[model samples]
Target: MIEMTRVSSPSDIIGIRDLQALNLKQNITAEEAIDQGFLTAAFTIEYLQEMNVASPSIIAKVGDKVVGYALVATKEIRNGHDLIEGLFDAIDKSAYKGKLLKDVNYVVVGQLCVAKEYRGQDLVQKLYGHFKDCLSKEYTYLITDIAQANTRSLKAHKKRGFQIINELVYGEVKWDIVLWDWNLTD
Candidate 1:
């Protein structure tokens, strides 16, 4: 049976790293990346462990193997990431209606991915649903940035109820800062 839960053991973190390596932009072919989507950030074991301590990343596991993940991030964790730091600044200047995003209760979805074998099985959808159930009580909104060129991932997120709240270019890639407002749903 598949289980959806937060990272607990060191081996679970290692499983996440194993999945991340196969999906990272640098590790895959350009064609494959454009077709299957990719993870822009490469997280170290130390960082994953740190993130686990702050807010455990949610994962889908079958026995000992991690098949999918939705990385949960606190404000401190988001601010500390070099790639996501720019988003923190952009969101501080952006708002959901009248209030600044930074002015409200929120958390970031640092990165999300499913193992290649698990794709097309609705595991991504299940992971986000589980992620929301895990965090919606404490956070008013779930914010995440996706590479604009990644239509597959973007479509998946939008279908999950995330709306693009802002757009910012970081380096050559333009990112859409998407927000899933739990307040609106509540």
Candidate 2:
């Protein structure tokens, strides 16, 4: 009974936070990180609430339980957080196919995660497809960064049509900035 939809209620926000807690790099062990991928930044419900206000998240739910999510961070999020600002700064200096990314119309995937029980069910791709279906009209690309060591995430993004557009180090962690251009993918 899993369904794909936008974040529509306060509980969905908490669901995202709960799932994120289980998948963070520090929360998982090194072995699990290598095998399952990992998230770096830790965000509060307040921050997620703010981001959702500007752009609602794509989520996979079963009834009221959120099993997975792809959070969209529009330009309204820039300069409001330290780590995000660094990502934006790097994106501003980055180029894809000779055109600077800053000059392109895009939104960042603030965070993505699927509950452990929901993994291996093609839920990741399902969430991304929902992103395109809902956001492609307003945005040309969906952009985000994955830690270089988070190979699982990088491969998944590439498999989902995201291209590595740039790279940078923030908080001493090297990240691969990726983008899926809907104009090209759609």
Candidate 3:
């Protein structure tokens, strides 16, 4: 049976490992999915471990086999306030200024991946549902950015009701920084 669980505690190491392995094989390390200028799949394992203990995140599994994972940043960066300020300044000064940024309690989607064997099983869609359920209480909404060339993720996110609120250009690549306002009041 498949289950969605809040990833909290060291015992969840196995699930994180499984997610990392799946991500390495299909998304980052795979030639067809090489995403340069972004964190590699290898980093996802540590990211999950950190997020599981540090923030609101979820891990999906089937009998100890991790099939998918999602991360939400419901809290502010503890000591990275300066970094956030700099990022916002750069963004505001850029062409995408005067944009709306509401219910943006989450800063990033550290990682969201499914095992290759589990692809096309609607696991990702289910994971999105679970993630929304988990975060809607403590957080207003979630936000994430994707490379414009990443068509699969962009399509999936759009289908999930995320709108492209702003576009960012970094180095030689352009990113579509989207926002999904989960808070109806906002």
RMSD of each: 1.3, 1.1, 4.9
In model 1, the Cα lDDT at residue 60 comes to 98
User: Candidate 3, which segments miss by more than 4 Å at Cα?
Assistant: 21-31, 34-47, 75-104, 184-186
Report the lDDT tens digits of candidate 1 across residue range 135-170. Answer: 988988888899999999999998889999999988
Candidate 2: tens digits of C-alpha lDDT, residues 136-177: 988878899999998988888888999998899988999999
Query: Could you give candidate 3's per-residue lDDT for residues 1-186 as a string of tens digits?
Result: 779887765656666665566455344554546432222334445544555556756777787666777655333432233322333433333332254444234444655676667767777678778887766776554666666877777877787877786776654667676666675432
Q: What is the lDDT of candidate 2?
A: 0.88
The parts of candidate 2 lying over 4 Å away from their true place are none
Q: Which ten-residue region of model 3 has the weakest summed lDDT?
A: 78-87
- lDDT, candidates in the order shown: 0.89, 0.88, 0.59
Rank by TM-score (best first): 2, 1, 3
Model 2 weakest lDDT span, ten residues long = 177-186
* TM-score result, candidate 2: 0.96
